[model samples]
Target chain A: MTTIFGVPITALYGQLVVGLVNGCFYAMLSLGLSIIFGMLDIVNFAHGAFYMLGAVLTWFAFTQFGISYWWALLLVPLVLAAAGAIIERSLLRRLYRLDPIYGLLFTFGLALVLEGLLRYKYGVSGLPYSIPDNLQGVFNLGFMFLPKYRAWVVIAALLVSLTTWLIIEKTSLGAYLRAATENPALVGAFGINVPAMTTITYAVGVALAGLAGVLAAPATQISPLMGSNLIIVVFAVVVIGGMGSILGSIVTGLGLGLIEGLTKVFYPQASSTMVFFIMAIVLLVRPAGLFGRER
Target chain B: MPNIVKYGGYSLLLLAGILAPLVIYPVFLMKALCFALFACAFNLLLGYTGLLSFGHAAFFGTAGYIAGYLIKQSSFGPGLGILSGTLAAGALGLVVGNLVIRRQGIYFSMITLALAQLIYFLYLQASFTGGEDGLQAIPRGRLFWFINLENDLTLYYVVLAIFLGGTLLVYRTIHSPFGQVLKAIRENEARAISLGYDVNRYKLMAFVLSATLSGLAGATKALVFTFVTLTDAHWHTSGDVVLMSLLGGMGSVSGPIVGAFSIVTLENELSDKVGSFVTVIIGAIFMVCVLVFRSGIVGEVSTLYRRVVGQREQ
Candidate 1:
């Protein structure tokens, strides 16, 4: 019965919850992108494609092999991580010495190829993905009902993001990564296998996207076209957050997701463009991004 | 290439353009010309200026929509409609260029891309764009006061003229002293800055110029196709431009034209037989071009020609 800004409180809460769920996916994807950019100095334009691959491959396993969603949640990332390793080792490794923009162009092609192959086989119609039985119910949150699956997604995504953050910021491997990001030549001189490190870092970064895709499968219809648009919004999220800091990307992704939710509540028209509009404002005020240090 | 070879090639191409409509489908040629001009506009930024914009379609598509709307709804003639579209695109370029030029290199590409998506969303949601159905049945009305464009042949010439004009403009811009500054900035931004050139201003100018020409191409395409759709503004079209420029040869004057024609022909040939596989083919071509053919058709041929000549002289 209560109203805020002439909208029902329940509707507002529902949108916020939806936004938070979306934010989780953004956090995971952007975190991966930030990590990849930091270590490899290459923007993985195909991050979205890899994420879609995770979901598609998961769905493929489910339909063909009777593999459960629980298994997919663990298996999909590994499969894609291996795929990422191959891609990095074969295609991306050659372009490291060239301008970084070549990396973007190369991945953009990879995305087109991946999305096109899937579209050719499956057609453009949405493929159904059901939530696991245990995660089907809704939880009473006093003011509004929250879907159990969504809550789980939020928790799992947050946990994964935290683990990634800790790994990059706290561990000895993280130390090596940070060092390599700063000066690859110096780190290579220290007897660390930098090329191997580069390959593994790319694989892990892609695995994060795969994990997010698996989490997203039950919530949304699986489609070849799903990742293309979502990736652009994530790009905007990366720009606003600035790829310099790991936590910065996470917080920005979540924060932008919430803002998007609020916009949908207040004015649905601006919801799609709110993130980009905010990006323009952020670019104007701080060209280096909120968390990015000026080079 | 030597001046004799260059001028001879241009003359031959002009002759082909003048005579080809008789042999080939005017509609298809017009489409290719429009895309060729669009790629040339894209090349101005990416090739000459060393700024890769993933959002050039914002200008191309927006101009198409505007030109389509004006000629269809407002009864504006094609000339005025296209002119208005080009100017409007220039205005948009100024605004977007101002914001995106803040970042250099890869970030520039990302920001342009994100802003373009914003524009795409705007077109998708706006009523004027007709949402999903797109602005359809756009008449290719009379040019100035007379010239009937209802005939395919008449319209083909107009589109060709526009394509040539746009391309010449790009060529002139590239050879100008201003273009040299752009190349310098591309090679070394800090050095260009230290030399007392206002680097941002130069970049902004090139961006706006590229956006304006892209709009000109889009506007012509709208007239040629007799409709404007969301596909024109989509990021895929932006990617297509990048591919065209890259495949033909980035930073080369004739490269985008060759690239555009080849891609257009390939798509035309394959779209019927393979359906969605066209995307895969294009993507594969992109990968091949990036990996091994970085210099592109023109760049590689020129290099080879020079190498053989040098050997002969030695």
Candidate 2:
């Protein structure tokens, strides 16, 4: 009940919780982005659109077939992972030798296509996604009351983010990925099926995006345009974190989300522009980004 | 000579553009020219300079707002309003370009896009821009304070002149020593730096020129439509310009023009029929161009012409 710096502690903490909730999304999305950029040397511009698809498809599965949230959680990522693999093997693989910017452009086109098709079918409205019965209530944390679903989202996203990081950092497959990232041809010479790995890596990155989408659907609007809107901010987060470090992406994403939340509490008007402004300052001072190593 | 044929081809297209207003809709032609200028300015960066600026809509839309505000607020003539808008965008370019010139390739692109989004958010909040409604019904005014822009023909001629001037300016810049250095930096940045050229400065110059020209196009479009909307500032517009240059051919003189006209014409003719899928169609074209047809329509035609001519000579 105490006031901290003119704002009530509960109010401040509530905003921080909201910020961290959004940051969970930012962390997950940017982690996928860093993985894709690190290994493929291509910035996946379509990441957001795919994220949107996960949300939209979740809504579709439920409304059309009465599928529940648990089912969506289990089913959506697999479907998206398959779609990601197809997109990679069929199209993205061809762009590997071109300038990395083309991958950004080509994926941009793909995002447009997917979003456009969805928009054409569904219009621009946000379909309702009711929270599951188990996560429908609030948790009393004494000073600040947290919604159970929101807290679940945070925990799930953090777990997923850390697990992906661990898989890349600790596992043998992760070692191969690290090796291939450093030298794809050398890894290929070791008979590790580098091409298949590239496709799978891309699929994994997008599957992470899909998972984030599912986590986000109940909290935010499950709309076609949601992905494009969030993707820009995620891009800034990736830049701020630097594309070199996976852990950097997670930390920066979460921290920036909190900063953005703090900005919302202090100066509501600057919340949108704050991340981009930070990006400019970072580029000005550390052109490679705060966590990024020079290429 | 082949030079005469190429010049002849260009002249023929310009003449068609000038004469077509007599038969086709003047408004649509004006729209095409505005987009053509925008695409050409965009092409100047990507095609000739080898820098992909993914945030050009910031320049285009910001200029539109500036020109709209000036002409609507005061008695500023069309020329001065557009000039001021373009200068403002160029100044913005200097700031943005200075920040981004240090980064190369995709980093440069993401920085530009992020910075443009910041500008978009700024405009969205600022009072003078009229927010979501944008600055509507902006006065086109007179050229030189007396020549009436009310007449559609007069406005068409004015628009044509600006488009031609912009194209010529880009052409001259491309052929200049400055442009050569910009291309050198694009082709190989480390080598250009080793060869004693200040690469970042050259890049900044190119970026400013591109921004100014794009601003000019945006200001003109504002006058032609008498309205400036948030659509201009959106990232999608930036993507559209990239698509134009990509589909038209990057470095070639007429590629963006051909590319812009193709897209504008397609949108004009097909939007009603295709509905929202129009974006998907455009995106598909972008993917095809990037994946397979990196050289674009004009690029392919010229290459084919060369092969045919070479075979005939043999």
Q: Name the candidate that leads on lDDT.
A: 1
Model 1: lDDT equals 0.93
What docking grade applies to model 1?
A: high
Off by over 4 Å in 1: none
| Deviation from native of the Cα of residue A266 in model 2, angstroms | 0.7
For candidate 1, write residues B83-198 as lDDT tens digits.
99999899999999999999988899999999999999999999999999999999887888789998999999999899989999998988899989999999999999999999
Clashes in model 1: which pairs? none
Give per-residue CA lDDT, model 2, range B24-135, as digits (tens).
9999999999999999999888988788999999999989999989999988888999998999889999999999887888888888999999999999999999999989
Give me the displacement of residue A199 in model 2, in angstroms: 1.1
Candidate 2 residue pairs in backbone clash: none
User: Please, what is the TM-score per model?
Assistant: 0.99, 0.98
lDDT of 2 by residue, A1-295 (tens): 5987788877788888889998988899999988898788889999999899989988999999999999999899999999999999898989989889799999999999999999999899989999999999999987679999989998999999999899999999999999999999999998999988888889999999998998888999889999999999998898788888999999999999999989888888999999999999998888888899878
